[model samples]
Target: MKLSLKVNGKKIEKEVDDNTLLVSFIRENLNLTGTHVGCDTSQCGSCVVHVNGKSVKSCAMFAVDANGSEVTTIEGLEKDGKLHPVQESFKKHHGLQCGYCTPGMVMSSIDLLKSHKNPTEEEIRKGLEGNICRCTGYQNIVASVKGAIGKV
Candidate 1:
Protein backbone atom coordinates (compact mmCIF):
# COMPACT_ATOMS: atom_id res chain seq x y z
CA MET A 1 0.00 0.00 0.00
CA LYS A 2 1.12 3.52 -0.64
CA LEU A 3 0.81 5.56 2.53
CA SER A 4 0.84 9.31 2.40
CA LEU A 5 0.51 11.57 5.40
CA LYS A 6 1.97 14.52 7.20
CA VAL A 7 3.90 13.36 10.23
CA ASN A 8 5.43 15.74 12.73
CA GLY A 9 4.79 18.50 10.20
CA LYS A 10 6.73 16.69 7.49
CA LYS A 11 5.35 15.08 4.36
CA ILE A 12 5.70 11.29 4.27
CA GLU A 13 5.04 8.96 1.38
CA LYS A 14 6.05 5.35 1.73
CA GLU A 15 5.21 1.87 0.57
CA VAL A 16 4.01 -0.26 3.44
CA ASP A 17 2.09 -3.46 3.93
CA ASP A 18 -1.63 -3.05 4.19
CA ASN A 19 -1.53 -4.65 7.63
CA THR A 20 1.09 -2.27 8.94
CA LEU A 21 -0.04 -0.76 12.22
CA LEU A 22 0.21 2.97 12.57
CA VAL A 23 2.60 2.59 15.50
CA SER A 24 4.86 0.31 13.47
CA PHE A 25 4.85 2.72 10.58
CA ILE A 26 5.67 5.64 12.84
CA ARG A 27 8.46 3.88 14.68
CA GLU A 28 9.94 1.71 11.97
CA ASN A 29 9.21 3.50 8.72
CA LEU A 30 9.39 7.07 9.97
CA ASN A 31 11.94 6.37 12.74
CA LEU A 32 9.81 8.21 15.26
CA THR A 33 10.25 5.81 18.15
CA GLY A 34 8.65 8.11 20.70
CA THR A 35 5.28 6.48 20.17
CA HIS A 36 5.84 3.26 22.07
CA VAL A 37 3.98 0.01 21.57
CA GLY A 38 3.49 -1.36 25.05
CA CYS A 39 0.70 -3.74 24.10
CA ASP A 40 -0.49 -4.83 20.68
CA THR A 41 -3.95 -5.49 22.12
CA SER A 42 -4.65 -1.77 22.36
CA GLN A 43 -5.33 -2.03 26.09
CA CYS A 44 -2.33 0.17 26.77
CA GLY A 45 -2.42 3.76 25.62
CA SER A 46 1.33 3.82 25.12
CA CYS A 47 0.78 3.99 21.39
CA VAL A 48 -1.46 7.02 21.47
CA VAL A 49 -0.90 9.76 18.89
CA HIS A 50 -2.92 12.63 17.59
CA VAL A 51 -4.56 11.97 14.22
CA ASN A 52 -5.96 15.10 12.70
CA GLY A 53 -5.83 16.78 16.14
CA LYS A 54 -7.46 13.96 18.15
CA SER A 55 -5.73 11.32 20.20
CA VAL A 56 -5.90 7.77 18.83
CA LYS A 57 -4.09 4.57 19.66
CA SER A 58 -1.66 3.99 16.83
CA CYS A 59 -1.50 0.29 17.58
CA ALA A 60 -5.20 -0.07 16.97
CA MET A 61 -5.28 1.63 13.57
CA PHE A 62 -3.67 0.73 10.27
CA ALA A 63 -1.16 3.04 8.62
CA VAL A 64 -3.22 2.95 5.44
CA ASP A 65 -6.17 4.27 7.37
CA ALA A 66 -4.08 7.27 8.37
CA ASN A 67 -3.32 8.16 4.78
CA GLY A 68 -3.83 11.82 3.97
CA SER A 69 -4.22 12.64 7.65
CA GLU A 70 -1.94 14.71 9.81
CA VAL A 71 -0.36 12.49 12.46
CA THR A 72 1.39 13.93 15.48
CA THR A 73 3.48 11.62 17.59
CA ILE A 74 5.12 12.43 20.91
CA GLU A 75 8.04 13.71 18.89
CA GLY A 76 5.79 16.27 17.31
CA LEU A 77 4.83 18.00 20.54
CA GLU A 78 7.98 20.07 20.70
CA LYS A 79 8.58 23.21 18.70
CA ASP A 80 11.69 25.41 18.27
CA GLY A 81 13.66 22.87 20.31
CA LYS A 82 11.53 23.67 23.38
CA LEU A 83 9.20 21.26 25.10
CA HIS A 84 5.45 21.64 24.97
CA PRO A 85 3.75 23.19 27.99
CA VAL A 86 2.33 19.82 29.03
CA GLN A 87 5.75 18.23 28.76
CA GLU A 88 7.23 21.04 30.82
CA SER A 89 4.47 20.65 33.41
CA PHE A 90 5.18 16.94 33.61
CA LYS A 91 8.78 17.68 34.41
CA LYS A 92 7.92 20.39 36.93
CA HIS A 93 5.43 18.14 38.75
CA HIS A 94 7.45 14.93 38.47
CA GLY A 95 4.65 13.23 36.64
CA LEU A 96 6.81 10.40 35.29
CA GLN A 97 8.94 7.71 36.86
CA CYS A 98 9.72 4.81 34.54
CA GLY A 99 9.17 7.19 31.58
CA TYR A 100 7.52 4.37 29.63
CA CYS A 101 4.04 5.87 29.85
CA THR A 102 4.97 9.54 29.80
CA PRO A 103 4.39 9.96 26.07
CA GLY A 104 0.91 8.48 26.12
CA MET A 105 0.01 10.21 29.38
CA VAL A 106 1.13 13.55 27.98
CA MET A 107 -0.74 13.02 24.71
CA SER A 108 -3.94 11.93 26.47
CA SER A 109 -3.66 14.78 28.95
CA ILE A 110 -3.39 17.22 26.07
CA ASP A 111 -6.64 15.93 24.57
CA LEU A 112 -8.28 15.95 27.97
CA LEU A 113 -7.35 19.55 28.57
CA LYS A 114 -8.54 20.44 25.10
CA SER A 115 -12.03 19.20 25.95
CA HIS A 116 -12.12 20.31 29.58
CA LYS A 117 -10.39 23.64 29.96
CA ASN A 118 -10.29 23.50 33.77
CA PRO A 119 -10.86 19.97 34.87
CA THR A 120 -11.22 19.04 38.49
CA GLU A 121 -9.10 16.42 40.18
CA GLU A 122 -11.72 13.74 39.59
CA GLU A 123 -12.16 14.84 36.02
CA ILE A 124 -8.45 14.64 35.46
CA ARG A 125 -8.39 11.15 36.93
CA LYS A 126 -11.28 10.11 34.72
CA GLY A 127 -9.67 11.60 31.67
CA LEU A 128 -6.59 9.48 32.21
CA GLU A 129 -8.51 6.27 32.72
CA GLY A 130 -7.21 4.46 29.63
CA ASN A 131 -3.57 5.55 29.82
CA ILE A 132 -1.94 3.44 32.51
CA CYS A 133 1.03 4.51 34.58
CA ARG A 134 2.50 1.78 36.77
CA CYS A 135 4.61 4.29 38.67
CA THR A 136 4.02 7.62 40.48
CA GLY A 137 0.71 6.56 42.10
CA TYR A 138 -1.01 9.09 39.80
CA GLN A 139 -0.80 11.91 42.37
CA ASN A 140 1.92 13.75 40.52
CA ILE A 141 0.41 12.85 37.18
CA VAL A 142 -2.84 14.48 38.22
CA ALA A 143 -0.88 17.44 39.51
CA SER A 144 0.89 17.70 36.20
CA VAL A 145 -2.39 17.79 34.35
CA LYS A 146 -3.70 20.39 36.78
CA GLY A 147 -0.53 22.37 36.31
CA ALA A 148 -1.20 22.37 32.56
CA ILE A 149 -4.88 23.25 32.87
CA GLY A 150 -4.72 26.73 31.44
CA LYS A 151 -1.29 26.51 29.89
CA VAL A 152 -2.35 23.86 27.36
Candidate 2:
Protein backbone atom coordinates (compact mmCIF):
# COMPACT_ATOMS: atom_id res chain seq x y z
CA MET A 1 0.00 0.00 0.00
CA LYS A 2 1.11 3.52 -0.78
CA LEU A 3 0.65 5.85 2.13
CA SER A 4 0.82 9.64 2.15
CA LEU A 5 0.61 11.82 5.20
CA LYS A 6 2.11 14.75 7.06
CA VAL A 7 4.42 13.78 9.88
CA ASN A 8 5.92 16.27 12.29
CA GLY A 9 5.06 19.13 9.91
CA LYS A 10 6.75 17.28 7.04
CA LYS A 11 4.95 15.66 4.14
CA ILE A 12 5.62 11.94 3.90
CA GLU A 13 4.75 9.41 1.22
CA LYS A 14 5.96 5.85 0.92
CA GLU A 15 5.02 2.36 -0.13
CA VAL A 16 4.43 -0.02 2.73
CA ASP A 17 2.91 -3.40 3.46
CA ASP A 18 -0.75 -3.59 4.35
CA ASN A 19 0.06 -4.98 7.75
CA THR A 20 2.78 -2.47 8.62
CA LEU A 21 1.94 -0.84 11.89
CA LEU A 22 2.25 2.92 12.36
CA VAL A 23 4.93 2.41 15.01
CA SER A 24 6.99 0.35 12.60
CA PHE A 25 6.63 2.97 9.87
CA ILE A 26 7.61 5.77 12.21
CA ARG A 27 10.55 3.97 13.74
CA GLU A 28 11.75 2.08 10.69
CA ASN A 29 10.83 4.20 7.68
CA LEU A 30 11.06 7.62 9.28
CA ASN A 31 13.81 6.68 11.71
CA LEU A 32 11.96 8.19 14.66
CA THR A 33 12.80 5.76 17.39
CA GLY A 34 11.49 7.83 20.27
CA THR A 35 8.12 6.16 20.01
CA HIS A 36 8.74 2.87 21.77
CA VAL A 37 6.83 -0.38 21.45
CA GLY A 38 6.70 -1.86 24.93
CA CYS A 39 3.68 -4.09 24.48
CA ASP A 40 2.63 -4.83 20.91
CA THR A 41 -0.77 -5.93 22.22
CA SER A 42 -1.55 -2.26 23.08
CA GLN A 43 -1.62 -2.97 26.82
CA CYS A 44 1.14 -0.38 27.24
CA GLY A 45 0.73 3.09 25.83
CA SER A 46 4.40 3.25 24.93
CA CYS A 47 3.63 3.65 21.25
CA VAL A 48 1.28 6.59 21.59
CA VAL A 49 1.34 9.35 19.00
CA HIS A 50 -0.79 12.23 17.88
CA VAL A 51 -3.04 11.54 14.91
CA ASN A 52 -4.75 14.70 13.70
CA GLY A 53 -4.10 16.30 17.09
CA LYS A 54 -5.48 13.38 19.12
CA SER A 55 -3.51 10.79 21.06
CA VAL A 56 -3.60 7.27 19.58
CA LYS A 57 -1.51 4.17 20.04
CA SER A 58 0.74 3.79 17.02
CA CYS A 59 0.90 0.04 17.62
CA ALA A 60 -2.89 -0.14 17.52
CA MET A 61 -3.20 1.64 14.14
CA PHE A 62 -1.92 0.64 10.73
CA ALA A 63 0.22 2.75 8.45
CA VAL A 64 -2.52 2.71 5.82
CA ASP A 65 -5.07 3.95 8.31
CA ALA A 66 -2.88 7.01 8.92
CA ASN A 67 -2.94 7.98 5.26
CA GLY A 68 -3.85 11.61 4.56
CA SER A 69 -3.66 12.40 8.26
CA GLU A 70 -1.12 14.34 10.28
CA VAL A 71 0.94 12.32 12.72
CA THR A 72 3.20 13.59 15.49
CA THR A 73 5.70 11.41 17.26
CA ILE A 74 7.81 12.17 20.32
CA GLU A 75 10.55 13.48 18.09
CA GLY A 76 8.05 15.96 16.72
CA LEU A 77 7.13 17.31 20.10
CA GLU A 78 10.13 19.61 20.21
CA LYS A 79 10.23 22.90 18.34
CA ASP A 80 13.39 24.48 17.05
CA GLY A 81 15.75 24.10 20.02
CA LYS A 82 13.22 24.07 22.82
CA LEU A 83 11.47 21.11 24.34
CA HIS A 84 7.70 20.98 24.47
CA PRO A 85 6.12 22.06 27.73
CA VAL A 86 5.08 18.50 28.52
CA GLN A 87 8.62 17.26 28.04
CA GLU A 88 10.03 20.06 30.13
CA SER A 89 7.50 19.43 32.87
CA PHE A 90 8.34 15.76 32.92
CA LYS A 91 11.99 16.53 33.27
CA LYS A 92 11.44 19.11 35.94
CA HIS A 93 9.12 16.88 37.94
CA HIS A 94 11.15 13.70 37.46
CA GLY A 95 8.26 11.98 35.79
CA LEU A 96 10.39 9.29 34.16
CA GLN A 97 12.72 6.59 35.41
CA CYS A 98 13.39 3.82 32.88
CA GLY A 99 12.20 6.25 30.16
CA TYR A 100 10.57 3.48 28.12
CA CYS A 101 7.12 5.00 28.60
CA THR A 102 8.09 8.68 28.66
CA PRO A 103 7.18 9.40 25.06
CA GLY A 104 3.68 8.05 25.33
CA MET A 105 3.23 9.64 28.72
CA VAL A 106 4.14 13.04 27.28
CA MET A 107 1.89 12.56 24.26
CA SER A 108 -1.07 11.46 26.35
CA SER A 109 -0.49 14.24 28.88
CA ILE A 110 -0.47 16.81 26.10
CA ASP A 111 -3.90 15.63 25.00
CA LEU A 112 -5.16 15.57 28.55
CA LEU A 113 -3.93 19.10 29.17
CA LYS A 114 -5.46 20.28 25.92
CA SER A 115 -8.93 19.31 27.09
CA HIS A 116 -8.43 20.32 30.70
CA LYS A 117 -6.21 23.30 31.18
CA ASN A 118 -6.48 23.05 34.94
CA PRO A 119 -7.12 19.42 35.61
CA THR A 120 -7.38 18.25 39.17
CA GLU A 121 -5.23 15.46 40.57
CA GLU A 122 -8.02 12.91 40.10
CA GLU A 123 -8.60 14.05 36.52
CA ILE A 124 -4.91 13.77 35.74
CA ARG A 125 -4.80 10.25 37.16
CA LYS A 126 -7.91 9.27 35.23
CA GLY A 127 -6.60 10.78 32.01
CA LEU A 128 -3.47 8.65 32.30
CA GLU A 129 -5.38 5.41 32.60
CA GLY A 130 -4.13 4.22 29.24
CA ASN A 131 -0.45 4.84 30.06
CA ILE A 132 1.57 2.81 32.56
CA CYS A 133 4.83 3.82 34.21
CA ARG A 134 6.49 0.99 36.08
CA CYS A 135 9.19 3.02 37.85
CA THR A 136 7.77 6.38 38.90
CA GLY A 137 4.83 5.25 41.00
CA TYR A 138 2.81 7.94 39.18
CA GLN A 139 3.31 10.64 41.84
CA ASN A 140 5.91 12.53 39.86
CA ILE A 141 4.00 11.85 36.67
CA VAL A 142 0.94 13.46 38.13
CA ALA A 143 3.04 16.39 39.30
CA SER A 144 4.47 16.71 35.81
CA VAL A 145 0.99 16.88 34.32
CA LYS A 146 -0.08 19.41 36.89
CA GLY A 147 2.97 21.53 36.24
CA ALA A 148 2.30 21.52 32.52
CA ILE A 149 -1.40 22.26 32.88
CA GLY A 150 -1.36 25.90 31.77
CA LYS A 151 1.86 25.75 29.80
CA VAL A 152 0.50 23.52 27.08
Which regions of candidate 2 deviate over 4 angstroms? Answer: none
Per-residue lDDT of candidate 1, residues 1-152 (tens digit): 98889998999899999999999999998889988989778887989999999999999999999999999999999999999999999999999999999999999999999999999999999989889888899999999999998988
- lDDT, candidate 2, 13-81, per-residue tens: 899999999999999999999999998999889999999999999999999999999999999988988
Per-model TM-score on C-alpha atoms: 0.98, 0.98
Model 2 residue 76 CA deviation (Å) reads: 0.6
RMSD of 1: 0.7
Give candidate 1's error at residue 4 in angstroms. 0.8
